[model samples]
Target: MRLDLPCLGVFFLSVIPVNASIRERLSYQGLFGCVHSGLLDHTGCHHFLRTDSGMEKTKSLIARIQFGKFFAILQSYANKDHFNYVQFSNQAVKMNQDFLEIKRLVESIPEHDDLASELSFPSHMFQLMAHSATFLKDTSNDKSRGHLSVYHLIDLSVRILALHNVRGVLDSTNSISEEKIISLHRELRELVSTFVHDGDSESIMNWMFQDLAIQAEQDLQKLWQQVSVHGIACLSKTDQQKCIQLP
Candidate 1:
């Protein structure tokens, strides 16, 4: 029943195209059909397709979530300061709100639309918020380990924000250029390097960092192969090696 993180990561990467296809196939009628068969009703379908306002609301919410004061709190916590429980909790609540809004917006879109590619499930962000909430409750009496958990939470939040920003850019343009992909890889590398440290060796945090870096590298490689003019010509030899380097 327990799934390995690395395997789950690979599974996620492998399913991107399939998930995109499935999302593209979604339609109001299809949703209504699901309702008609006792799955959902007219009211539920309407809620699902709140498309007109949902998309704009989702974008606004995401922008606020990504560029808000929440990240400042995360930065403080990441720097080994005492964990601000109130601030962290407030931000987690905001993240949950963003997640729900995104889910609703994605549901509202018609099937086979290019806009669907712009929205991802925000699975990592959801998991990060859930875990942070649980850690807050469970470690109320253990401030020492709580700091470590907070560090992990901060890293997760940064990763989520980076992904959201990248997806927003890709979605707006509806196409990925070689330069854009290269920029994405560079941004990912910089983000990963920001928190990864030698002192984290043998810790769960270290493992998580490694897993994220490896998965990112693999994803970039796959994406490069998918869209590169000559399947790696876009990258210099040094960059190519960097793309495959593990944490």
Candidate 2:
């Protein structure tokens, strides 16, 4: 009998009830859990309790996988340009390292510790978003026909990044100061405006690096204004400022 997993929004051929016990559910379906099978155990922690409501988690995971595929497509574009694969691979490696770190931290903390998970998960998502952005910046050439260019991918990455970034800021223990919130929204709106202005590949790649600079500079000035009010600790300071600087 075929079964549809409601929480996962995935279809599976299972001759068992969806409401069955977790152990039995796995057995009846003849499926093995990657988390439980010691694949992700190298980082630490063995057991992972499936979230009661997995639809959202499934969606999140799916988005994460799509981002990976997007990166792959960007790789192909870069390959055609005689671009160094090592450059892109290095960026992805750094993100993966961070991803593992976040995963380790999450395992050390309780699943119910919403604060830790919220802070960490966004970091992981940001890495994915940043990777996509880098792919666009590095590989873009002369292309059209609604093809994925660096700017198109950058816009998509910014959308996802801004969404998760807002979530991260909101989930923090400190009350979100008004100034910081405004800066966040402003930065997001700037990204949105870029998307609106250049919906095509050539235009987006050019605009993302060119027209967006003035707006990005303005954002930094506004951020400094925020820093004056909120202080620097409100931000996640990193030594690698290269990522923040647009190409």
Candidate 3:
């Protein structure tokens, strides 16, 4: 049987893993760093931090530069008033260089703890957000050229991360406009909605708990609504009208 949003929420919300404050025990950076904590048990990060491989760091930097080049070409045809998904698909590649840089950065552990922590956020974000491809993109199908796909969201996420310093709505940036922010939020919901039509219940459920809502950090919009806390009021037909007062 197919589970809709409300059923999925109810089915999983109560069972939402508790005990360790994922927020406290596993911070975004901590999780990604293989803190024994998470970001896949914090294993992969050690190599990146400890490696003497200047070659790896050089590769990551080159990937970032390449992304900026591609993105600049994309921006030229953005057509702000109305998004051009076709033009975008024409440009958006399945595997982005931005993600490649992120992956490379995470793999090479630097000597300084502070530096590793600093790179943690983007690396962590990449870990959490990179899989939109599984549910959001289908290379064999015409899905990539569809209205929305993994390529679009990854590009958007990377751009916002760059423009906003990975702060999303938390920090202010003169470079990105109010319209851009609004559009980004809308795109997030649109991407999320697509999840319903794509992946199976188990996989989607895992992502919700592990990445999107994971306390282990790298959650794109931690500062956004506490859907878990407010699900009751939001769902209650009688109570839905009132404001949700967080305790």
Predicted model with the maximum TM-score: 1
lDDT of 3 by residue, 1-247 (tens): 1222231222122222234354432332232233222234334555534543333222223223333344444455443544444444434442243444445545454444333333434434444443443433334255434333334454455454443322322323233333444344444444444443345654433343234323322232442343323321233423322323234
State candidate 1's TM-score. Answer: 0.46
Instruction: Quote the RMSD, in angstroms, for model 2.
Output: 15.7
Cα lDDT computed for each candidate against the true fold: 0.47, 0.41, 0.37
- Regarding lDDT, does 2 or 3 come out ahead? 2
For candidate 1, give the lDDT of residue 234: 39
Candidate 3 similarity to native, TM-score:
0.31
Q: Each candidate's TM vs. the true structure?
A: 0.46, 0.33, 0.31
* Residues 119-235, model 1: lDDT tens digits: 444445545565555556566576665566566556656554444444333333233433555556666656555446537575545544555555555555555555443332433
Count of backbone clashes for each model? 2, 1, 9
Best by lDDT: 1
Clashing pairs in model 1, backbone N/Cα/C closer than 3 A = 24-112, 35-40
RMSD of each: 12.4, 15.7, 16.2
Order of the predicted models by TM-score, top scorer first: 1, 2, 3
